[model samples]
Target: MAISYSGYLNLPHGFRSHDILAFHDRDSEQTAERVNYSKNLLEKGILWQGMPACLILQFKKKQQVAITLLAEGGKDVSELEILPIVQRMLGLNQDIDDFEKAHYRHPQLGTLVKKQAGLRVPLSSTPFEALAWAITGQQISLAAAISIRRKLIKALGITHSCGLYCHPNAEVITQLGQDKLHQVGYSKTKAKTLFNLSRGVIENTLPLDDWLTQQTPVEEISKKLIEVPGIGPWTISYGLLRGYSWLNGSLHGDAGVRRGLQKLLGLESKVTAEEAEKWLAPFTPWRALVAAHLWMSL
Candidate 1:
């Protein structure tokens, strides 16, 4: 079922239609497909067995959230539990200022990045899913990772509509043995690691939600995430930044990030990850935003 709602939000300075659309695209990739863009609007286009279902998101006056849902003919949008989903999808209840100050800025790096093309920081609902996806993507070109993920989701993940699947939950992964995972293109070791991580989530050996909400600090969250099998520091940091919305974590080890930084700095030799951190210090809280800009710039 599909439904839509629209409203306004009061946002911080530097908030633009593009910014909100970028956020929506990042946050909704697992649930939606082909978010079409224009000057002031984001149109989420969904295809169920090649039929069209659309959701249009528009922002007015910075602080408002506007939603519109389009379903197939005769489908009852009124019966769907849509408002809450829209709210969550828009992150309407979350504080945008902190996220803005920490991640979005208008400084040197920010300016360069904003001037670049097609850069975006994508987000996921669950840290576990983000972590797993990051692992699956490691050392592989993005296209390869995406193809593998599509197959993986088709094999083990559940879909709300045809060809639209949510990231598999811990329980789902726990039920899919390593052999099954290997069939989805995971190396045997990677499959085992994924299974172990899923077990951790299902058995509550790892308090995923608590850890995300814990007052222990971002560094601690990164550390704890890294302790999980198949999750490295890069994956953990990206999860915290993109999944939990931690503003200060810079994805230094990412090759894309490195390439972006090199282009930004005009360096002859690639900057080491440590050096990249120092270079990114100026962006501070908005490092992730800067990172997004950098990615877009490239």
Candidate 2:
């Protein structure tokens, strides 16, 4: 039998479900896609206590969100347990009013923010997933990275009866081993980093959960993540942004960010990383959001 729960949440001012859906739908890889977004609904498979369940979020006309979680085959999960995960995935907890107010009059991002108000950073279901994605996308085209990600999930993730794959957590990835990762098209360095990251999580040495629970400072976690081999500033920054919603991470090293800046500036030449960094410095704590707005502009 399938078990289910439903609830309603007041949408934040300027919240646009389409923007969140578009961000989630960016990767078009196969393998029983974990997240499925349509005009008014989103279906996603999420693992809780190692059991996979399907979550549905349906947007309503009055800025109210209807959330539902369906667990198949008598698997037990509480609405309380699932709501927080839903909140994170939807970025409901991330307040963007300050970012909007601060940048609404700016030269470059002003118009973009106004047009894209209530844009929130859609977070990974788990920190490990974000870290894994950052490693997977390093120095690779987005399409190629998404292809590899599909393979990885197909190889190791638990599939719900709903036909969606629950993103593999650290324990699942660790058991797959580096050899299997190579089969999924991860380079040796990336495979090694995955192994290292998964092991750290397994051993509690990385303390990703602790960091999230305690709301640790981004600099503190970034310092720790940087020590892992094959994990550079870009990886750390991207991971923190997607994983923790730390909006200050400088994404100057991202190609899409540079391209967005170039287009924004109407420059004929490519924007250098240094140039991007300098331009973004004024944004300070909202740099990642600024980068996000830039990506949307593109």
Candidate 3:
């Protein structure tokens, strides 16, 4: 079905055109293409056009916002719960101030280029997709991860009318088997991990969506995530941050984040996992944003 989605998110001060570009780049290249294809501009919010959908968005000083979605026929806007879906997808539900404080300025790295009070935190609606992607990304270059993901998605992801690919659900992955994933270039261990994660999601062993609304502490969530085979601390933390949008969470072991911090602090080598936690202490609620910025810096 063809559906267009768009919305304005209140951004924080120091937020710039480049920052938005950088954020899109960090998240997904396909999304970046969608954003650019829409011909979006900083002054004009975000503007996009394509087969699946097209849209325009405008944000004012990270406060007031507006959005327009254009879809060709299959589903009516009102019937599809568009607003809530867009809000979640754009991460409008998060508090930018909280995020900013959680990812405070580093004593050694200096100030961030943008310091807005309400920057948006983008997330995937499909937690399974996020978790699976996080697993695929472990210990690999971002470019390599994307290549594998593209191959896997092409082989298994759901496709819409305009050729837009939606991530497959856990059930689909579980049914696909480890051998299929291996064919997509996943290491044997990685394939096993993906299958195990898929099994957890399918059988309710890992209650992903429930955790989002549950009162469980981040530590508890982290522990549960780690209980799954192939999901280590870094993978769990990454899932919490991106899939669940858990504020204050940091992926200390992420190579990209570590490298970014090293460059930001002028270190000779990547910060130790322990040191990374210490270094990120000041940016409590917004550690995710700090990670976002670090990704951009690199």
lDDT of each: 0.61, 0.83, 0.63
Relative to the true structure, candidate 1 has a C-alpha RMSD (angstroms) of 6.2
Candidate 1 local lDDT, 1-298, one digit each (tens) = 5543333445434444464465545533444444446546655544322234555666666555566656544354441345543443444444444544443354446456335422334455456766677777777887677767767776854544334454576677788888998998988877877888778877877666667555457776666667766777677666666556665677777777888889877899987889878877776666665666667667
**TM-score pick, better of 2 and 3:** 2
Over 142-255, each residue of candidate 2 has an lDDT whose tens digit, in order, gives: 989888988887888588888888788888888999999998899988999999999999998898978987899888898889889999999998999888888889999999
TM-scores for every predicted model: 0.70, 0.93, 0.75
Clashes of each: 15, 0, 13
Q: List the residue pairs that clash in candidate 2.
A: none
Give the Cα error of residue 185 in candidate 1, in Å. Answer: 1.4
Q: Say which prediction, candidate 1 or candidate 3, comes out ahead on lDDT.
A: 3
Across 14-131, the per-residue lDDT of candidate 3 in tens digits comes to 4444444344444364631234424443111111211234333444554544555555543445524455544555665667654445434545433653433345556654466678
